[model samples]
Target: MTTRSSPLPARLKSLLLLSCFLGGIGLMHAENWPRFRGPSGQGLSTEKRLPLHWSATSNVVWKVAIPGEGWSSPIVWGKRVFVTTVTDQSTRCRVLCLDRDSGELIWDRTVFEIVPLRKESKNSYATPTPVTDGKRVYAVFGDGSMAALDFKGGVVWTNREISFYSRHGLGASPVLHDGLLIMPFDGSNRVLKAGIWPNTSDEERLGWQIPWDKAFIVAVDARTGRRIWTASRGKSRIAHVTPNIHGTGRKAELISPAGDVIQGFDLRTGERLWTAYSQGEGVTPSFAMGEGLVFTASGFEKTTIRTLRLGGRGDVTSTHVAWEQRRGVPSQPSLLYLAPHLHSVTDGGVAHCYQAASGEVIYAERVGGNYSASPVAGAGHIYFLSENGETVVIRQGAEFSVVARNAIQEKTQASMAVSNGRLFIRTAGNLYCIGSKH
Candidate 1:
């Protein structure tokens, strides 16, 4: 006795579903350069036909003057771009939002009024790159402050949790996993709870034992700024290596490098799973992982490049280590892998190529200029950015061949960001967008 309603025709339903699926594919094509090295944190963008050759005068879509000092790179999301800058002699930490299409400065908000601490000559207050997840942007500074701002530049939350900052300042940026913000606080010199540094007019610090255990990796709620998990690096020396995921899929392991050790931990619980051997006191470079091997370069002293086999429990010091490259390793710039070979440009501009699995030296050649910005690879070419504004683009293969020697002729320390077939470079003087009518 009930009236029956007929379903839509099968062909019509299929057509409607196909329409929605294609719409989603269109949205996915709208990419966002989210983190330090784009989406994968490897400086490899899926964006094809990126502008290969660019100068201050050529392919310049828009150039805007940035009014501050920072080493953080620009991150783009949809139609907006985000970057952080610390001005007023490193006292003001600011978050800048710009139009991605026109490079117009839409909003600039000061996140914190910081008292800049003793930092290395090269490290600025706003060295850690801000990360965005379309809803909000996150920034961290040298003065031990991290702030989350909404997409429209409203301050959502701020945390000054670890005041014991080291001398080299904050450089490792926060990474987003699921619903949390992962930040690593690794400093060489630790400040006491009373804010007294080792030699900062406080002779009392000379007699007191400086806590080398102050360094740690922490995760906070992305929306609330509340601590979710923390793992202590009490046995670790100071390091600034940013944490990255190791495994594939939704459940991946987190790996963080310390002074003399690289530890793997559970991302959800922060429980230590394994620790690998990496020698040196200041482990600055982050790890590059793929194909069952995790590659890392130790800090200045010794500078040993290690390739460890991933997926193990407990101590992986000897069991998981695959190979080690002892010479011409980098301390500041991270490693890049292009198929069967791994590439690295040392801080002194020495370019190296090694076998990905065996660590066999393929070729060693010197490019030019002292390098701090990590090399980025694109369009079958590897880009090595130097501190003096020169970028050497080389062919990516077993043999080393320089493609072009391009420059903006301005000092810059940030790595280039590629998005939507355009290259965004932040220098000491200006922010430039490079494109070729794409």
Candidate 2:
């Protein structure tokens, strides 16, 4: 009798990995953290059972030490999780992929070499979160270098056609839609000349911000990195808001918040469709889309929440603006748009709930500790990640009630990612996966 040996262990493992990469292992159409915030480009996810409480020791799935510094949140697709970090002491922009099941380092690929720019004490060189559409991942750095990589860390393309340097470094993450990679280039030469960005005592004269004339939104082919179109923001100041893809069918629009003005771009051709005067500078909060309205927090100065009607042309500041509220608007954290109520947490730790359409303040409560991460909602609860790595879970409703306080006791600035009932938190030194069973 002839006996046949089973396939080798290594070959079986490889085949299994390939199958998972091709959407095996019960991985359906749902994406975990494919983009900056999560699927739908909002902080909210459809995850039903994220961990309610977890300390550094409790409910700890795995903790992996990350090299260098990065404020970008971890993104996931199928069985893999990808995060961008600066290696070689912030001199190289690199992408690290980890196996979602075991937290094993699958691969590490350095995309580009970048000189350190004068960033704020809180900002990092690898601040922009990498986004993926399952088959490939896209990572961009503050130096305006971008690259595309396959599932196995093979580099597919690199595009350096757009060069950018911000005095506060780059915080605007790229968004993908309609086969285009959209990036916001907002920096201030005035701030660079004044040496105003936090007084970093770099001996290399670390501040270099070009004039506002060069600041605009650029669209490149997501698969090929080919330039598609460029739209000038026109005298807009520095902003860090990410674009929100809203509307449906032929009326789809890319609503982006530019400092001093907010505008909508055509998703297909990068055409300037509509414009509004946001009347602010350093706008950081990403625009929230819901109920045919676009809501935004006009950054540090002239801070307020502006809600505008979806479709408008030219200057729609007065014509299409539904309401403007100045109550507990956050400068850094974006709001959670859950139909009737818009939830938000300020950098100073005050949480507020507002009526979505009319801009009416429902309730304002102080949850404590500074927050830079935006609010993400799942399983009928909203989560707010503070700068000190304290995740305050609150029941979402008309009245704000604290559900639980989970403290990890680490420094975290990146927003949290939720998917498949798991919460991914990225701190200054490590990446922790909660709700994972070892």
Candidate 3:
């Protein structure tokens, strides 16, 4: 009789160790907004006691003018806060680092100037939020210039290899996984006119002399800013969604939205793992991970939301789909999954709660305004920011219940950041730090 021995492959064992390594360290900088949707990319802040109410004139700890125009949210690390902005002529790109407590501008560095300007009315030049790893801060502009600066605002390294179209501007934020800083290049290859974005492909889909909108993700060394890997995302148009890291039993993959597909790539080498064919095009929604599923939403054309399961080899569309939801998914705003319940506000202001596991609607009610910014979850409450400058707090559960409604005097389309037990909200005019500070 022959005896058989069973063992795991060396590659599989290595992947297991990688997963363990990522899990051991904390994802978010507890007192920092390192990426788009806060730490862990779920929009939930582990803050102990965030303020429940605040206004333009009351409960405001400090207010600071943001300089030029860019709707990017603020990210803070240690004592420094960072945000990106562009000049009024849309030529010069800059990043400002401020003192976290005093709101003092520590360093304002001009990154670059656009040679030939390109911009859409709806998109600004510096819409992508910067990412920091406590040591250095990274920012990318609409012109495809990526730069890194030390905590003291000294230039570390800059890359001007890629050239991106300036239309609808670059809104995708950068993220850090392991020691690599990842950024997305998603936009039209050529200049897009105002009336060309709608239902016509003749004038809208013309190829550019340089294919900047090839739909790809690039990873760079966090410390040195060297190009580590570049993964192509096929031929897709513009996407304003930021990428997030997802955990599997095997390894953590960078989950990103490209056109009508949600893809997963190897975190270290940018190897394409898998891509799920999302039914909708022009995907602007980011991924939310929880309950063993990755939720993705689309913006234009066929609007729908799909929940995908993690860990699969090639196109795992059939094997990994957990559930799908079609009602009230936001085009621009990201969704929040709070175990057993998923909450999101549609572009039309319909606040919804769905059973995350089953994709069944628990409640869909109107909250009364448009929402472009993603909500922040903290202290057992969900804070929804509307375009009309209203912050509506609701209890997080299956049933819908409003906790409080706080309205700022100014209109804001930017998201809120919670760090170091304080809520930092970026409005159209100023950055307000809301907390007791006592």
**lDDT winner:** 2
| TM-score ranking, high to low | 1, 2, 3
Model 1 alpha-carbon miss at residue 173, Å: 1.0
lDDT, candidate 2, at 387: 94
Candidate 1, residue 2: Cα displacement in angstroms equals 58
Residue-level lDDT tens digits of model 3 in 1-438: 998888889999999999988866543334677777787777988876788878777788789988778888898787777888877576788889888888888989987887534565655777788888788888988777899988877889999887666345577888988888899877765543542343555435532212233668889888888899999876555677899987743488898977666788888778888888765555566778886688888766677778888878788878898988789878888899898888889988899898888789989998777888898899899999988788988888877888888888577778888887778888777888877755
Compared with the true structure, the alpha-carbon lDDT of candidate 1 equals 0.82
lDDT sort, best first: 2, 1, 3
Best by TM-score: 1
Candidate 1 structure quality by residue, lDDT tens digits, 1-438: 899889999999999999999988864574688988878787777764666677888888899999889999899998898889988988898999999889999999998897777777998888888898889998888876888999888999999875746766777878898888998887765545556655663432221123265577889999999999998766666676778877656558888887778888898888888988667766677678778898899856667998898888988898999999887688898889878889998998999999899999999998989888887877788888889888898988999898888788999989888877788889997989888754
What value of lDDT does candidate 3 attain over all alpha carbons?
0.79
Please give the range of 10 consecutive residues that has the lowest summed lDDT in model 3: 204-213
lDDT of 2 by residue, 1-438 (tens): 999988779988998889888865334443478988898888878865678989998998889998888999899998898999998879988999998867899999998997677777888888888899888999989778999999999999999887676757788899888778888887665233434443444422221221155577888898899888998776667778888788666787788887778888887777888788766777888878888888888866778899998778988988998899998888889888998899889889999999998989999999999999988988889999999999999998999999999999999999988766688899999999898582
Kindly give the stretch of ten consecutive residues in candidate 2 with the minimal lDDT sum: 202-211
Model 2 residue runs over 4 Å out of place are: 1-31, 190-211, 436-438
